[model samples]
Each structure stands twice: as structure tokens, then as C-alpha cells.
Target: MWLDKESQIDLLAYSPFAELITNITANERLNPLTIGLFGRWGAGKSTLLKLVEKNIEERDETKKKFVCISLNSWVFEGYDDAKSAIMESLLRTLMDNQPAFEELKDEIRSLIGRINFMKLGATAIKHGMPLVMSAINPATATLTMAQYFSKTKRKEILNDIKQVWNEKEIEEDRDTTVENIRLFRKEFSDLIDKSEIDNLIVMIDDLDRCTPERVIETLEAVKLFLSVPKTTFIIAVDNQVMKYSIENKYPKITEGSEDFSDSYIEKIIQLPISIPELSETDIKNYLLLLICELYLSKGVPSIKANQLDILLSKVKEDNIFVNGIKIDLEFVKSAFEQYDYTILDKGEIDEFEKMFDIIGKTSDVIASILKGNPRQAKRFLNSFLIRKSLAEIYYKTDRTFDYAILAKLMALEYIDMNRFKELYKWAIENQKNSKIKELETITNISRNDEELPEEYRKWSDEKLARWLKSDPIDLHEKDLLKYFYLTRESLDINVSVSDSLGKAELMVFNKILQSKRATEYSLLIEKLKENKDIKYTKILDALIEEFKKNSKLLKKMQPLYICYSEYRSEIKDVLKKMKITEINLQTATALCSMYQADKPGFSDVIKSWTDKGLAQDVLDVIIQEK
Candidate 1:
């Protein structure tokens, strides 16, 4: 299995994009630039960031040098406010790295003192303190400590801050919080200028993971404090996630008027460099390289490290007319020739070429399902290898199982797990070559049919049909016990860890299950507003188990919780699957009471309750509410 980390090598042929960004960033004319490196999560945004940094570092021939720095913005998310966190981190980095600024250590230390004071003044209330800094603005330094803290303690905290300016020497007019903020920016900028560093390049990563507040705060800090001359900030974040963050922080925009988030990010990010989703060709080449590299790592005599590059160069060019990498026999022959299999005789070479063909054919399906994501491609490849490894060891009697068949079945399992299980069930009950009659129409048919089985009808989807028509399409002749044997552990493991909720989720989940009073669910209500889908599923799963474990305690609030969730559409599906025997008129009344409109719009949900043994009269009353 390969480690899921950023790589220095450009395996996805993403070097051209990385190099373009490096050129744009390295041009000193673009100093004071804020470049937003936008991509979906796991689209190699982080790896591309590394490539850009490496490119900049390699520019020793350029007369000017860069003082490159990296800040993982999410690291500061939970520990403290984003603005101050970034500010202090900058001070520490500059102070620690630049020995030329050794003489200014005292000044930098003084800067830290002032930042701490401002941070405490700005965020004292957010940490549950009653101190009102908003009223007596931190910019003005007129802090109000009397409401909560003891007067003596307040004085001690204030008096402990280093005296940056003497009261006797300076007028009272200059001691304002706003003045200090202006002074901090000037002083920090001065420190960078004085250090004699030609330029400062700070790349911020993982801002996508921050809360909306932190996301907006860090961006504000970058725009406000760090956009100085001779400085460039490359922030790697998902554009959509950033839009969500901006919308969350400043959500007062009138609908259809304009998207405030678009304007907001555009202003701060001078140049937004978006990394598009990997194309089908890019993903195919990526998978090809990954498989070859895996084999190379295993000391495969057929291929060498440099030859992998030769293969990459040829496939990435994709001159199919001249027989380069494509989904057919020609590409397989080309790969084997590039592999330089002189040690192998004609038979071994033929066998190895067949092995190469499996990667080619399977990758086409994998690429489509992976949605052109390099990280997803890597992960799928890893999982496929793990299953292959386990299949070899688990069924030692069937070590010669055709890998093409394993790849085909695993692709189905990876894509539609439920369908995979159904197929497995079909395969397990019979001998080799037993036909799955359901596939007769679903794979061959181009459109949906009312008479087709519900599960099989969904298989008529274009992508699934494409997968079904791939080589080894009819598994009727194959004994798939070997396939099921590998997925046995995987199937069990998926069930075991399916509902691994985070700490915040689990905490609120426990309270939801244990609480006797409806008033005690403020946290549950809050959590529902955020990440509600997963939270709803977890609650539903937990309630199912709770019903099995203790029917008495589970009956009170689980249905109420599910109904109170404003996600009426999703709750309808969850309720359909659930057996909430306690979903009576009182529970219905409680749920409807919170609905704003006369039409509460869960007619089907209430109608389905009669089948779960709801009283006919009670069902009539609930249905009337709709």
C-alpha cells in the first residue's frame, strides 16, 4: 500500500500547471499578491502547492532570493482566533529563522506582547468571559474589566504587558487600540523589510478545513496585515468551501441580488488559480503510473524506475494512431515493450502482457467512477492491490485466480456495494457458470423498464452499463467464491466502523439518547443545523440499536428528534426505514406544532405509520395536519 501523502514527483502530469503557477508567483512584479490555489479536496492542491514551493526554491540562478514560509491555517483553527494565531506564528517564524534580525529580537518580543494584549481584548467574550471589549474597543485600549474580573486581577493582567511606550514620553492621544493595530502592521512590515530578505513567500494550506469564522478571519488577516510589498501569499483552499465560509460569516446578502461571497474572495485573492478536476485521460495516465510504480517497488524484473518515466512520457502524449496508451491490445503491447522484458522468454512475456491489459481495461471503469480525482484514483488502486494481496493469501488453493475478474468484481463492489452483495448472493448459491438472470436485461437494455427488478433497473444507468459491458461482463461461467472470500473481511470491517462520529457529534448523540426532557436538546437542535445528513443517519442508526437494546428508553424522543429535524424530505426516507412504534398523535402533534405552514408536508410519512401499527383514529388526526 502506498502512503497517502503529497509527493515531490508530478505523477499526474500536473507539472505543467504547477510550473505555470511557479512562473506567475516567482515574477517579483506580482509581489504583494494573494493567489488562491483552488481545487476540490484531494485533487492534489496540497501536492501542487509543494511543487510550486520547490520550483521557487530551485530558482537560485535568479538574482533575487525568497524567504519561503508555509502555514497550515487549520492548525490555528481550534487553538485560538485566526488573526492573532497567524500574526504570532509569523513573528515566531521570522524571529527564529532570520539570524540577520537577531538585533531586533527585543522589538519582535515586544510585538508578541502587543499581539497577546490585542487578542485577549478582542476575544475575551468568545471564551465565555463577560469582559466587553466591543463596547470599549480594543483599538482604543479602554477595556472594561469590572463586569466579570476582579479589579486587582484586571490590573495585574494589564500591568504585566510590556511598556512599549512611556506615558510621560507620549501623549494620551496615541494610546488607542485602532492606533496599535495600524502600528502593528507597520512594525511587522518594517521587520520584513529590515531583515534584508529579498522577498517573503508564505503559502497557506488547509484553510478549507477551518470553521467559517476562522476561514474568514484568516483571510481578513492575510488581506489586512500581510499584503505588504515584496511579499506573496499563496493560499491553497477549495473555492466552493471558501464561498461557503464567506456566506456563513456574512450571510446577510439578499437573494438574487448578488453572491456576496464571490465578490468578497475576488477582492482578497488578487489572482485565483483554479485546478480543474482531473480529466479522463489524466486519471488513466495516473493509474497507469501508480500500477507500474507499485510493481517497480516490488522489484519486478519486467520494469525499471526510469522505464516507468518512458512509459509515462509516451502515454501522457496519447498518440493512439501510433499505438501509444489506449484501452486496447496495442497499449498493452507498447507497455510490455517499454518494460524491456529481455529476461523473460516469449511465454512469460505473453503472460506479463496479459497482466498489463487488466490494468488498462479496469482503469477505464475506475477512472469514470473516480470522477477524475487523482487522490480517489490512488485510493482505489490501493484498495484493489490490498484485495489482490489478501485474495492470494486467503485462498491459497486459488492463487491462480484471474486478476481481470477480480478487478471487474472489485470495481462493482467499490462503486455500488449493495449491488455487489446482491451479486455475491447470486453467485454463492450455485456452481460455476451459473447465470444471474437479472443481468440478462439490465446490462443489455439501454433504458429503464417497469417490469425489471428494482435493483437491476438502477443498473441500466449509463455508467453502470458501461462497467457491465467491460471485458468479463458475464460472470455466469465464473466461480465468484474467490471474489467473496476477499471482500469478507472488508464487508465486516465496513459495518464495524460505519458510524464513527466525531467527538462533538458523539457528545450530542449521547445526550440525545439519554436525555428525558425535550428542552435538553438545544445541542441536538444546533448540530442538526450543521452536518445534519450524517448526524441524522447516525442518530437513526443509534436509535435502531437503541430500540433493540432498550425499547422503553428509546421510545420517548428518537422519533421526535427525527421529525423535529427540518429536513422533511430526508427524514421521510429515514422514517420509512425505521419502526418508530412511538410515532403516535402526540409525537405528530409535537412535530407539527413547530411547523410554520398549515401544510407540514409529510403526508406519506404519516400515511406509512398505520402499517407500523398506528391507530386508525390517531392516523386520521395526524394525516389531517398535513
Candidate 2:
């Protein structure tokens, strides 16, 4: 199927990668630069590299010649083999386009020979083959060459090369092989240097799939063997893998040593791009567009643009992370819907729910795992689609949409169940009333809807609690608080007086008060004061209320309070002027008692007020009692 082009949702969309590419391409620098594209496994580093390559190729006709060589080091057995494969791949590309590369043919061929012959004699000896025998017979040599370079033989050759090529040998070949390699790299580099090509960007992908030793070797080859001028290598790799690779490849490079701190490899790289989580809008948009294209391609006339938008919008609103890096949940949902096997008639809200169920569960489960990284989100969704497709074919039914199968798929994705449990607990226990409200909406949709099966619907708080009690996962306090607040918001639940007494509630309340948009602070404080269960002294609550009401005035009158130490006495006078009674004090005290505090005067006032009748005289006595 032909893929439709849309806005690239990758590193290039991020400001740093975009600017780095633009700067490198526009600059006149002759020195080659290396950049490490780092993120966890499943991050879209390969996609980003492809985008860069596309941009480079589009500009090739006008500016410089650009070639993108993507080598998966994991495909090879060792570093030397990977390097040879990478070199061979580049040479083959040039050789294939020999008409265009005629001028650089000799240089390319010479570089290839240097790489091929670097350890020829040693490899021959190690393989227990006569070195001169194959060298003498051209016809037999060609057949032998093919046999010797077979996959298994290639590994042997590479191992033999590494064993024989010591530091001295590397130093000896430094002038011829290294120079030619540099020149070979320069063929592409010089094109960028002379022409309008923005960059000669080589993307190294799938490094994480390689053995640690092979990974290190590949990196060392890039740094030491292929360090050339006027080029840029964007490596798609894992951060931890890169670290291990560097340390293993160059052991002498320690943390504190001058050379250690600024390793040669590290120095060549100007930008180290760490792919962050995608924003919710971006993710949704990407999914929505992808789904639209897929449906149109499949000749599905039922899916309308507006309907798609509505479905996507709802998913985005419900499934999104509030504060963390957001990606459009709607887009992801749309993708699942379009690619889903069971295609219902258009405008079928039930079908929509079914698709949403799949998307929501997948998103929630994967989100719990990757915490909403767009790349990971896409990876998880794509994998689910594949598995579901296979299941549909195998089962001869739409059991692919089953929640149990979905859960199994999620489990297979390596989603850390422990992490999910911890996050869920934190969400439940620490979520604000507002956040709870939002989560409740999702729960309601999941529960009240007929589309979700009864079994899945039965997975409620009690079940969650049981699961937690059994597993005993530790919930991060901050995450718990955030979840609690958000949950409350989602549920539209008011923070009760009882809730205000809880440590978690108090922490969140204070945090909200200190927030930038604290217009509700006074209202919140008033509610807290009114809550009988809040047992803190009323004086403190009253003082806080007064502070909220006259915060600006208090700031202005701070000097007045300092100048007149007796100014505090006016509080009682003001109460007297307002005709506030001992009964009022008793009421405040009773409310405060709900917090379990003992206040003698408040108790005495309450007892007296109770004994006195509700006549004017009693009212007057009550007023004057204090």
C-alpha cells in the first residue's frame, strides 16, 4: 500500500533536532560531526533518521550529493564484520551508480581494497588456507572468494582480522587504510562540502540488537576507523548500550582522566538527541491522519472526516497525560480503529466504542509501561494490530477484540506489571478530586458501556486493591498525589472537610494554593474552614482566611503592624464591634472539635449557650459572655 505523507512526528519536529540539522547543513564547517540519537528501545530514532535522509535527498539535485547508509550492526556477528558490511554497503551503492560516481571510482575502489586487504595475510593463516594458492588462480579465486565470504566464513575472517590487527598494525595502516577510509568517507562529505547538500548524514540503526561486544566494536569503528571531515553520523541507539559500548571499547578512558572525561568519540558528536515523550495533540493528530489514509486506501466509504475527528477528540481528552509530555491520544485511537479487523458500518457508535475499547486498553496498558511516549505508543499499537490480525485469521472469529487477548498482548509487550500496579495505586490514592473525576470518566465509559465485556468491567477498585495487597508495590508519593488530584478533578468531587484533614489532601491543597492561578485559594480555604472534620485551631484557619481576603492590604499594613505592636489587640475589639457572640465562638470550637482537638473555652461557651434559653436576654448574655 502506498503511504500518504503527513507531518513528520519525530525528532525533527522537536526544536533541538530540527535546529541542529539546519545549522549543520547551512554551516561551512569542514569537520565531520557525530550525533547520538538516544532513547529507550522502541523510541522512533530510525524514523527520525529516515526523515533527515529524505530531506537530504530532496535537496540533492540543487545542492550537494547526499547518501544515507543505514547499517544494522546486530545483523553481523562482531564489530569488524559490521564495519566491513557497512563499508561494503556504501561501496556497492556507489558501484551501482557508477555512471554518476565515475570521477570517484578509483578512490572508492582503492578504499574498498584497503578495507578488504587490511588483514588478508592473517585471515588466510587463521582459516588454515594457502594464501598464495587463491591469490594465483583468478577463476578458482572468485569461487573461493565467494565461499570464504559466506556468512560463517565472514565471521571467521572478521575474528581473524581482529586477532592479527594490533594497535601497531592499526597505526601502520593509519596512513593508507585510515586515509583511504577518510577519503572514501570524504567522497560523500566533499559533495556536501562543495554542493548545496545540507549534510552527508549516515544513520546507524538497530545497535541495541547487537551483542554488547559487537555494539562496542561498531561504535569504536565509527569513532576511530571512520572519523572523517565534513560529515555527520546520526546513531540510533540506546543510552545504556552506548555507555557500555564506549566503556568496553575504550577501557582506558576513565571518568576523571582528562582524556577520559573528553573521550575522542564523545568529542566528535556535537548533538546528543534524547527523544522525549510526544505531546498528546501530536500523537492524536498522527493517528487520526494515519487512520484516515488507511481507511481511504481500503475503500471504506463509511468513515467521515468529522466522525473520525470526534472519535479522536474524545480519546485525546480522556486518555491524555495532563502535565507530562503529551501525545494526541485521539490519533492513536483513530489508528487502531482504521486498522482494526472488524469494520462496522459507518456512524456505528457501537463500533466506535469497540474500537475505542481496544485503543483505550492498549493505550492505558502501554501508557502504564512507556508512560505515553509517542514512539512506544505507536510501537505498542502496531504490535497489537499485527497480533490481532493473526488471531482473527487463526481463530476464524473476531476474538482478537477480546479483552483477555488484549491483556495477554499487553503482557507480551513487556509492560512492567509491577510498574503498572504502582502507577495505578498512586493514581488512586494520590489523585486530586479533579484528576479522580477524569479517571472516573474513563472508568464510567469502561463500566457503563456494553461494548466492554463483563469480565473486564469487573476489574474495579476492589480488584485493584486485592492485586496491590497481594503484590505490595510501592507507590511514589508524588505520583500518588498527582493522580489523586487529577482523579478528583475528573470526578468533579469537592474536597470534603474529612479529606482536608488527610496528610495527602493537605499537601495537595497547599500546593494548589501556591500555584500560579490561585484565584480559588480563598474558596478552598473557606471550604476547609467550614469542614467540621478539619480539627486545626479556628484561629489559624481564620487568620489564613483573613490573609486571603486582604492579602494585598496585609502587605500594605505589614509596616503598620510592626510600627504598632498593640495593633493585634484590635482583633478582639473588631470582634466586639461586629457583635460576634460566645455562641459563635462555641460553634467554631465545635466545628474544630471534629478534628479531635480539645478547647476548654469553646467547650464552656457551648455548655453555657445550651443551658441558656433562646430569649433576647440569653442572646445578649451570650454575646457579652466572652
The clash tally of candidate 2 reads 42
Q: Write the per-residue lDDT of candidate 2 for residues 1-626, one digit (tens) a residue.
A: 22222134332244346555645654547346677788777556666666666566565643335555566666666434555666566566655553345466665665566565335434654565433223323344333434445557655554555554422233221222233344445654453344343345567788876776667556645664465564567777887776666555446645665433234345545677787765544454344333333332233357534334444344445543333334343444454445443332343445445445445433433344454355555555565556555555655553223433343334322443322443455366645633434233334444443232222322333333223222112222123332222222223333233333456456544543454432454344334435565433222323434443443223222222222222323322222223224334333322233212223423443344445533454444333423
The C-alpha stretches of model 1 lying farther than 4 A from their native spots are 61-64, 95-114, 117-177, 253-259, 297-305, 309-338, 341-355, 431-433, 440-455, 489-626
Residue-level lDDT of model 1, residues 393-486, one tens digit each, is 8766865687788888888876666457657777765544466555545655533323334324445445676677787765656777778777
Q: How many residue pairs clash (N, CA or C atoms closer than 3 angstroms) in each of the candidate models, in the order given?
A: 5, 42
Model 1 TM-score is 0.66
lDDT of 1: 0.64
On lDDT, the candidate that comes out on top is: 1
Q: What is the TM-score of each candidate against the true structure?
A: 0.66, 0.46
Which one is best on TM-score? Answer: 1
Q: Positional deviation of 99 in candidate 2, in angstroms?
A: 7.7
Q: For candidate 2, give the lDDT of residue 188.
A: 43
